[model samples]
Target: MWLPNKNEKKKSIASIANDFIGDGEAIFCDSSTTCMHLVPYLIKKQNLIIITNGLHIATSLSERSDAKIYICGGHIYNSSGSVLGSSASEFISNFRADIAFISCEGISKNGIYMSNDEQAQIKEKIITQARETILLCDSSKVNKESYYKLCGYNNIDTIITDKKPEKNSFLVNTDIELLYPVE
Candidate 1:
């Protein structure tokens, strides 16, 4: 399928962040690069609380107003600047949030998967605790697979992408909601 330029897609997807998130709500944000795009949008909301293992997301939002930032304690990875491990998962599972914005390496009929298992554990744990679980991905990622299956398509409440998905039974028969930027 033909796709938009990478920069445009990133901007479109980043803007949708505010639509899924709300003011005064607490959310769990995954450590994916896509999550960083959301921090700017979230900074504008009032009384927003953010919980994550992403060092970048934590520090960037720290100086912002009307928000609380919580970083999961665990072994911090140098490469991605994300903290992960059993300790991280345990820490994340302790608090409940309003929503979780997670980005994965790929997604297929089997499930949404991630590149790292440790980050996947934290995401899955947050999925259980948060009232809403929203998957942030681009159309290029659809029908692809990753190393760890974080959750099945049915598990998430909605998926916000830069483009709308083609008609498929996995999306048609299930309760999953799909969102995209307006033309």
Candidate 2:
């Protein structure tokens, strides 16, 4: 299967974003390039409080957007411009959000997984507290396995991808709602 280019993968983010963000919902946006793409969709919302560890997500929005933002407090992972560590996880857990938008390094029978355990812990905390969870990943990540499990397919309410999996793929058999770009 041919992997989608960066732009193809990015186009799907908007479609997924529109599905997740309601006017006044509180959301936890993960520190993934996929989640960062939500910035555009949020520009017109009102009474939104975007809680995130992704510095880019928090910083990218224009002050004119009217969305209130909170940066997760913890050790900053400079390379990725994300906040992590125990402190961050604890802080994020204190609030129960309406939804969480996350991504992982891989997806398989075991669960969706990410490379960093600290981020994984934080994502896990958010999932347990969120009313619903939306996972954002391109098709290339399907069937791949990563070091740390973020959450299981059972935990996901929806998944948006840029590629279509075969009939026998794990995603096809799941109850999770699948959203793909209109093309």
Candidate 3:
């Protein structure tokens, strides 16, 4: 079997996510490099209501689709170009999305995790408010652990990654639907 490289993997993950999205749907996208890759695919959709904390995601989506980009107001993390804080979490709670696309620093037997506590708080809120939660974690982040645990594997509706995890991977033990590129 052939496996994609880093950049190819990210695009593959983004492509899988695009399959779940459709015209005129509302979605919540977190500020992760994986989610950033999703911007180009989003541009092809019509009347998409994209609510995001990613400064770049919002900017890229705005250039083509003007009306529906909702950027949350909060403290912007310069390193990652993400807006995260109490304000951001509060803002996210106001809208109900058909899906919440998110990524995290790591995933392990315990649960999903984020290095930043603020991001974790917002993600927890995102999981509850959205109809479905799609976690976009690359192969590298799988089987790893981070500081703040976001939620258990059961909390996620589906997981899209560049490759299928090893047979013993904790991800495979869960009931969550796992998706990856077949080629």
Best by lDDT: 3
Question: Model 3 over residues 123-160: C-alpha lDDT tens digits?
Answer: 88888889999999998898788878999987899999
In model 3, pairs of residues that clash are: none
TM-score of each: 0.89, 0.91, 0.93
lDDT (Cα, tens digit) per residue for candidate 2, span 1-183: 111235657667656667668899998888887776777787778889888888778877645478888888898886787799899888887888898888889998678988889888888988887899988888889889888878778899998888677778878888899877665
Error of 2 at 116 (Å): 1.1
What's the TM for model 1?
A: 0.89
Q: What is the C-alpha RMSD of each candidate to the true structure, in Å?
A: 4.3, 4.1, 4.1
TM accuracy, model 3:
0.93
- Find the candidate with the highest TM-score and give its number: 3
CA lDDT scores, all candidates in order: 0.81, 0.80, 0.87
Question: Per-residue alpha-carbon lDDT of model 1 for 1-183, expressed as tens digits?
Answer: 111234666567878867877788999998777878787788888898889988878877886656888898989877787899999998887889999988888888788888788778888888998999888888788888977888887679988888866666354455687778777
Clash pairs (backbone) in predicted model 2: none
The candidate 2 region of ten consecutive residues with least summed lDDT is 1-10
| lDDT, residue 80, candidate 1 | 84
Model 2 misplaced stretches (Cα beyond 4 Å): 1-6
lDDT, candidate 2, equals: 0.80
Error of 3 at 43 (Å): 0.3
**Candidate 2 TM-score, true structure as reference:** 0.91
